[model samples]
Target: MKRFAGMLLVAVGVAGCVSNPGVVKTGPSTYMVSRQGKTGFAGIAGLRAKAMGDANTFCAQQGKQAQMTNTSQSSGMPILGNFPRADIEFTCVAMGAE
Candidate 1:
């Protein structure tokens, strides 16, 4: 049991080390992958919209989803220079979750 507790502590420490909202990455492309993992749910809808393949179509399709939120679009890429890449938010909170 002592060994197990030590291992659990180590795992929790590692998880805490990896779970920081400040650590984020970004990229640019016609497509958008979520950075909320890095950016937080602040970006989930935007990411979903990007993943939808057609921004307008995706918005139209998702407009009614209860979880969907209105997000603003920028004329230029938000993260990188329009290159397809991803962001990882190690600190993003898991919802209704443990």
Candidate 2:
């Protein structure tokens, strides 16, 4: 039973892992960030928040500000292998540039 319990624990831990691919450049000055919530209870809002944070951080690293261009999210049923996910598109622009 102990071995079964250990395996179950490991599975749970892996199930809760969040998948985030940092900012990806899609075009000149434009980037995209995507995040997935693997757990059943993970919500779309949380995934979007994390993606937005990642995009902002990436822009900050370049001494620019992130201006969001588009945002998308999908609600998923984890039991069916679908996981909540969010994607955000943004552009890094000079400070005060709209």
Candidate 3:
């Protein structure tokens, strides 16, 4: 009883510690955004927003706009693995001069 509860708590804590989403620059104008577990499908809208925001920020640093070019999703193993993973690909395009 008590031992089982403790184990459950540990499992939940571990699950909560899953990796955070990240953006990886594939090229000067391309990037990939990805995340797992709660940061993925469990909170899909948040993930998308975060990914887009990251891409936008990166492009902004170089004076450009972030444009989403592709997206992907996958369901992982239950409990012991990431249940859902999300990925977004984006390109940075130069903003026209005002």
Pull out the clashing pairs in model 2.
none
Write model 2 residue lDDT over 29-97, tens digit each, in one string: 789999887766788888888898898888889898899999998754565446677899999989889
lDDT of 1 by residue, 28-68 (tens): 21222232222222354454444333333332443421122
Ranking by TM-score: 2, 3, 1
Candidate 3: C-alpha RMSD after superposition: 3.6
List clashing residue pairs in candidate 1. 28-82, 28-83, 35-39, 36-40, 37-89, 38-88, 38-89
After best superposition, candidate 3 residue 48: deviation in angstroms? 1.3
What is the lDDT ranking, best to worst?
2, 3, 1
Choose 2 or 3, whichever is better by lDDT. Answer: 2
Backbone clashes, each candidate: 7, 0, 0
Cα lDDT tens digits, model 3, 1-98, are 99999988877786778875577878876799876665323765666677678788888898898888998776555565555666889887879632
**What TM-score fits each model?**
0.25, 0.76, 0.67
* Candidate 3 positional error at 77, Å: 6.9
Candidate 2 overall Cα lDDT vs. reference?
Answer: 0.82
Q: What global local distance difference test value does model 3 have? A: 0.73
